[model samples]
Target chain A: MKKVAIGIDIGGTNSAIGIVDEVGTVLTRGNIPTDRHSDINLYIDDLAAEIERIIASTDVELDIQGIGLGAPNGNYYNGTIEFAPNLRWKGVVELTKLLSERFNYPVIKLTNDANAAALGESIYGCAKGLKNYIMITLGTGLGSGVVINGDLVYGHDGFAGELGHVCVENGGRECGCGRLGCLETYCSATGLVRTAYELLGKSNKPSVLREVVNTEKLTSKLIYKYAIEGDALANECFRFTAEKLGKALADFTTFSSPEAFILFGGLANAGDLLIKPTKEYMEANMLEIFKNKVAIKPSELPGADAAVLGASSLVWKELSK
Target chain B: MKKVAIGIDIGGTNSAIGIVDEVGTVLTRGNIPTDRHSDINLYIDDLAAEIERIIASTDVELDIQGIGLGAPNGNYYNGTIEFAPNLRWKGVVELTKLLSERFNYPVIKLTNDANAAALGESIYGCAKGLKNYIMITLGTGLGSGVVINGDLVYGHDGFAGELGHVCVENGGRECGCGRLGCLETYCSATGLVRTAYELLGKSNKPSVLREVVNTEKLTSKLIYKYAIEGDALANECFRFTAEKLGKALADFTTFSSPEAFILFGGLANAGDLLIKPTKEYMEANMLEIFKNKVAIKPSELPGADAAVLGASSLVWKELSK
Candidate 1:
């Protein structure tokens, strides 16, 4: 019989479940649409049913050791999911209790998606054997997970490592978190598009972006494409984004002093276009004590497998601990 | 018979040695001038002699279990003091090995003066029972120590928590570390004097400060005195320092999510004059998730004893671990 644990990555829109072994290999996986009902209990019930069905269909005889979950606003200390902004859940939800009752084994753990991804990197990706590192996810909004002293820096309230919200430029841009000049407001995918629009207003650089602007459609992918084709405005947007990201990272280095920083998610796919400038500026701005010592690299994990492996590996890692 | 450890805090000018018990009590203490000899071995010989003399003079019947030394550039992992600018020592000095040879017992220890103070706070002072907090020392230079997950955040190569070097303003002020606009260049006692001189250049509103334009004549204590007498420029200097400090702290909160921040050193004696503005601005600038949640407070330990207690506490804490 194979020993495995069930890993669940619960997003605001969808949920994914996978059977993962000790070495972080996924055997089988399934997904379900997240119901946005006011009652969180109903949502948990629906998720439990879907998980039971997936387990019943799998032919491999497996001893399911536990379950690990990753969700927005998930508290590792309390095993509860607090009021996640993107989700319809109003108050705190005791997820571990409900899931453990259904599984009949330990519903082992919970952490925010960013921390989960960081754990995945530490356990099975580029950050292997590294005691100190920061995992940055540049998606809809920037998110980060900090590792210090060979363990996750959970802080006093399990809310540490909120690096995206750190104010980089004072009074520069408005953020979804209702803050002024947060790092995410100027560095994420949306931030890149916003920069492209600002560049358009400043200079009349005749380029392919002008056509996209006329259609009222602009995305980071579109901007990246135009920049690669030698569009001046689009290239400037990437340079501006990398500048802000590098300076902010230099400041963060003073606090945690990680060995390296691993970039993940959609925007990170831009590769050297983003990494080169960021590395240049970060090294230029970093303290002399930290200069030429820290490494800045992209995520090595496969994207589709990252979230599931990260969420599931939390159970395996915790159980072994 | 009781068991004890000898804790040594080596500074640029002087060094403090104490025999500490498990309950954070300094049974006996001694001080000696830091001899800056060209040979590293000579300095170690002097240090060992001082320890032997202090031990022989004490009548207390206690078994010395180990020794802990805190220096300027102490590396906990390598057990060596790296190139410390203030000290005459260059390159790596293996003080741990020398101390162990003299005592004939394992000298289990590590970290610098700033981190030692943080350990002291965690084990004996206001941060007792707390897992995450930052300790800032406002002496000749600004020093910081970060605690995450109940341990000192020593990043790769043991050089984490250089908060003083984090940039507060771009191209604002030149720092000793060859960085532009570092936080310590604007927040420490020396920084306060520099700010007063800069304010003198920018503003006409002044009282007694005009007479003292040179930094050699100006002191942080004198600046506080003038500010107490309602000098607008002097008060503005403190406010400016506090604002920069508070904003920087808000940035740190995003990474560490600490319970509280403890301030130590001579400048911390400014009390509410410094604490009030820092608390106000820090709260005002923090993210909604952290608003009014973390405390900005003063250190409870006395200045003279805090470093010694902190250095000693490192042994007890590490032994317990």
Candidate 2:
């Protein structure tokens, strides 16, 4: 019988479930609407049923190993998801305890989506054999997972590695966290569009982005589309984003001196359009000994399978331990 | 026979040698001039002789366990002192290898002085029983050692925890490291003097400090004296230094969420004058989750014996591991 681990990605809108084997192969996948179930017990029941249905449909004889989850505010230490703003389940939800009771599984690991991505990258992706590196997810808000000496830094509380919240411009931009000049305010996917708007307001530069200015349609994807086509103002937005991220990365080097920084999520898909300038600015701002040492690379995990693979890798990591 | 470890604290001017037992008592102590010996071999020979003399002077029968060193720019991985600006040795000096060979001792550990302080605090000082904390030494230049999960964060390379070089204000002050606006440039013993000078230059509201302004007699000690005596400008210097340090500590909290920040060295000796304002500013600048969570306290290690004790603790830590 083939041993398999359950991988679940809990998003605000929907939850993705996948049965993954030892080698990161997703055998069967399914999804359920997370927003529809306001009640915690019903949500867990529905999730359990979905997993059972997926397992029953699979042809191979499978022995279930354990379950691993990637959620918005997942705490690895407490096995709970606490006060995630986008999730309907308010306060601390005993996610792992509830799910473990349903499945009767002895091992269940949970961490934030960014830390999960770091584990996946370490176990199966580009960061293999690297003991120290940082995983940065440039999504709606910048999220990060710092790996040092092959273990994730959980800090005193489980809330370490919030690199997105690190101040870059010292009161330049306002953040959702009620802080001034957070790196996320200028470096995330939403931040790219905000940068485009700021560039449009400040200068009379001729560009394709001008047409979508002040509209709800101003998005990072739109900015990337114009940037690839050589729109000067759109390209400048990426440059500005790189400038903030690059400087922040340089400052981060003085703390951990990580081997590399792995970029994940939507903005990272822009490839060299973003990575090239970020590396340049990081090098320019870096201290002497750290210069040209830390590499900034895009995530090597396949975009479609990354979320499930990351979640599954947690189980594999625990088993190996 | 009592088990004792040899502790060597290498400074720019002098080297202090101590023989310490497991319970943190200094059995016998002596010193040698570090600046007098430009040749590395002669320096090693003298240091070895000093250690031997100190060990022989102890009244109790002792078995030497190991020797540990704390020096500027000391690298734990390489066990060498590399490019220490204050030291006469230009390049990487193989101090550990040379000394170990001289003493024929197999176990010799070396790291930067701040890291030693952290190990000392963890083993014997106020930070006992704490698994996570940061050690900040506010000297001529600021130095730091970060502890996470009961172990020091050494990063990928041996050169982790160089928090002194982390920038506070972009392009604000010129640092000796050829960087602009490093934390050390605004918050160290020298930084306090620099702040006092700046305050003196800008505002004429200063009383006592103006007499010593631009003179060689200007020092952090003088500033502390005037501040305690109700000098407004002198107090402002402490406040400004606290502002930069407090904000930087808040940013650092986002990275490693340590339980406490233990302050060491001369500037930190101002007690409530610096700690009070620093805690206030750190709390004001901190994120919601970390607010009122991290304590800012002075180091409990005796000022006279701290260096040697810190060095000796390195041996104890390694042995237990």
Candidate 3:
């Protein structure tokens, strides 16, 4: 029988589940509406049923030993998800306990999505054989995981690597975290759109972004498209985002002195449009010792498979530990 | 025979040597001028001779097991002092190899003074039972050592935890490291003096500091005395220093999320005049989740015994390892 691990990546909008074999192959995949089930027990039941369906449909001789999950507020130390503002679930939910009871699997490991991505990178992505590095997820919000001395830095609190909330502008932009000038306020996909709005509002420059400026349909994806097509405003937005991200990256390097930084998620797909400026700004602002030392690269794991492999890698790591 | 470890604390001006027992007691101590000899071998010979003299003078049956030294830019991984700007040693000096060869001790361990201080804190100071914490030394320049999961974080290059140069301000003050607005630029004892100078230069405020403003003898100690005597400018300087320090602390917390930041050195001895404002400002600038969680406290290690004990603890740690 082939041993497998169930990988679950929980987001605000949806939850993706995949049955991953030992070699990181996703045998079967499925999704469930995470926001629909407000009741915690019903959610667990539904999730377990979905996993069972995936396993049965795959028709493989699968001996699933453990399950690994990635979510916004997933705490590795505690098997609970604590007050994930993005999720419909409120307060500390005993996620692992409830799921484990239903699945009858004792080895269930869970960490924040960012940390999971870091583990995946170390095991299967760009950070292969690298003991020290950082993984940055630049989606709607900026999330990060820092690894040093070959272990994830979970701080005193389970929430150690909150690089997104690190205040970049002491009092520049107001953040959802009730902090001023957080890195997320300037570097996230959300922040990119916000910067685009600010730049367009400040200047009378001509661009395609200005046409969809007032519409709710305008998104970072649209901005990325405009940027790829040589839209000056969108390109400026990417540049501005890179500049902010680079500056923050320089500051972050002073803390851990990582070998490299891996970029994951939506904005990472902006490619050289974003990477070049970020590298330039990071080099410009970096400490002399760290100059030309740290590399910023896009995620090496396939985009569609990243979250699943990242989540699955958690189980593999836990087993080895 | 008393099993002892020789502790050497190398500073810019002087090097202090101490014979310490496992219980953190300093039995015999001596000092040598560090900048006196630019020749590396001569300096090592003199240092070895001084250690021999101290041991001979003590007249104790001491079985010296190992020697541990803390110096600026001390690299644990390579056992070398690399380009310490403060020390007369210009390039990479093979400090550990030279000392170990001269002393015939195979178990010679060396780390940066800040990491030594952190080790000392965990062993003999307030962080005795704490597994995760940060030790901040507010001396000539701000230095830091981070302990997470009960181990010192030696990053990819053995240069992790260089919090002093973590640019708190992007383009603010010019730092000795040739960087702008480093945490050390605003939080060290020298930073306090710089703050006083800035405050005096910017405004014609009535205060006692104005008398010694232009003199070379202007010191943080004098400023502390004036602040205690209700000098508005000196008090403002303390407040400003605290604000800058606190803001940086808040940022630092985001990276490691340490339990408490234990402060050491001259500026730390200023008591509530510094700590109170620093804690207040740090709390004010913190992320909502981390607001009331992280504590900023004075070091519990005795000032007189701290350096010797701190440097000594490194050896003890290595022995156990």
Candidate 4:
């Protein structure tokens, strides 16, 4: 029988679970609404049942091995999720302890969602065999994972690599984290939409984006579609986003000089529209020593399953440890 | 027999050599002028001879272990000094190989000056038990050493922690590194002097600092003296320095959330005048998750022997590796 790991990636609105084999193949997977279950115990109970049902439905003869989970504010050190703003579970939630009680697994590991992404990329994606690099997930918000000397930088309090909150413009834009001039306010997918609307009003450039009735419903993908069609305002919005991202990257390089920055998520799919300008602006801002050295590339992992696979990859890391 | 290592600290104008034991004690040390020899080979020969003299003059029964060196732009991976602006030797110079050949001791190791300081702090100072902290030496120029998970962050290249070069003001001040608004421009000893002049012109407040005959020769010590004497302009200058330093520290915490920042050099000797205001300002700028958590403290290592002792700690790290 083939040994397999259970990988669970939990987010604010969704929870994805996958039964993965050694080579990173997801034999079976399922998604459940994360925010629907306000009661903590009921959510865990339903999740346990769904995982059991998925394992039973699979045709492959598999030996259950270990479990790994990635979630917001997940603590690998103490195995608890502390004060995560998005979670319905208030204060400290011992998700590991609750899940382990329902399963016969000997090893159950947990880490922040971004850390799992970093490990996943290093083990199964574009960052394979590379030790020094940064993995950034630019979605509703920007998430970053810093790998130095081939290990995740979990500082004294297990809360390192918060590059999104690093200010790009002093007192510029108000962040959701309640700070001014955060990189997240200018570089995230939502930030792209915010830029789109800002530029929509700031300039009089004729574009397809102007036809959209609901500006609040505007998504990064829709903006990318318009930009691909040579819409001037949409292209300018992406250019604006890349400029802030590049400037922040230049400052970040001065800290731990990474070999590359692997971008993942919705905005990254825009391809040359974002990457080309981001690299151009980053190189323009960096010191001559750091110029033209760091590569900015998109993550190779499949977008739909990347988070689940990344969460699963944590088991391999823990096993080796 | 007592095992001892030879420690050499190469600087722009001076080089210090010492025989250090495993416990980070400097047995005997001497200084040699560094820039006097413009030729790299002559400089290496003189340094090796001085190291030999220091080792021979020691009275204790000692078994020579190995050698360690700390220099600007020292590569831990290559054991060579590359493109050090402060050094007279311009391009890549194999200082470690030459010294190792001159003295037949094996296990020669090299790291940047700030990295050496970090190792010294972890091994011999307040951070003996702490695995994660940042050690900053605020001398004529600013230097930083990042300790993560009990090791110095030597990234893809041997150069990783260059916090001094990170932009704080964002096109606010021109730095010697050809960058504008570097943290070093406002935080170093020379930066304090620059702050004094800027404040002198901006303020109408009476100050003892006005009595200085040569403004160009003004020092951080002089500024601290006037600040202590209740001079409002000097007090404002110190406050100005702390505010910049604090804001940068808050921003830096977002990168690697160290437990504390261990400060060294002449400016740090001012005690509460700099530390208190810096702490207040840093906490003010930080995101809520990082506020009031990181400590900023003075270095406990003796000033005279710190560089030599720090350089010597590299051998211990190598032996473990």
Best by TM-score: 2
Q: How well does candidate 2 score on lDDT at residue A54? A: 95
Per-residue lDDT of model 3, residues B1-321, tens digit only: 998889899989989999998888889999999999999999998898999899999878998878888998899898999888889889999999888788886478889999999999887788887878889999998888989889898778887888898777767899987878888989998898899889888989898888777664889999999999999999999999999889888888878889999999999999899999899999998876677888888997788878878998888888877
TM-score, prediction 4: 0.96
What TM-score should be assigned to candidate 2?
Answer: 0.97
In model 4, state the lDDT of residue B244. Answer: 88
**Candidate 2 lDDT tens digits, B21-99:** 8988898999999998789998888887888787778789988889989999899988999889899999999988888
Better of 1 and 2 by lDDT: 2
User: In candidate 4 chain A, where is summed lDDT lowest over 10 consecutive residues?
Assistant: A208-217
Candidate that scores best on DockQ: 2
For model 2, the docking class works out as medium
Provide chain B's TM-score, model 3.
0.95
- For model 4, the superposed segments whose C-alpha errors exceed 4 Å read A204-216, B211-216
Q: Write the residue-wise lDDT of candidate 4 on A104-212 in tens digits.
A: 7878888888888988888788888888999888988888889997888878887788888888878888899988888899999989988998888889888788887
In lDDT terms, which candidate is top? Answer: 2
Give fnat of each prediction, in order.
0.86, 0.73, 0.74, 0.78
- TM-score winner between candidates 1 and 4: 4
Can you write out model 2's per-residue Cα lDDT over A159-208, one digit (the tens) per residue?
Answer: 88888988887867899889898999999999998898798889998887
Tell me which residue pairs clash in candidate 2. none
**What DockQ does each listed candidate score?**
0.78, 0.80, 0.76, 0.77
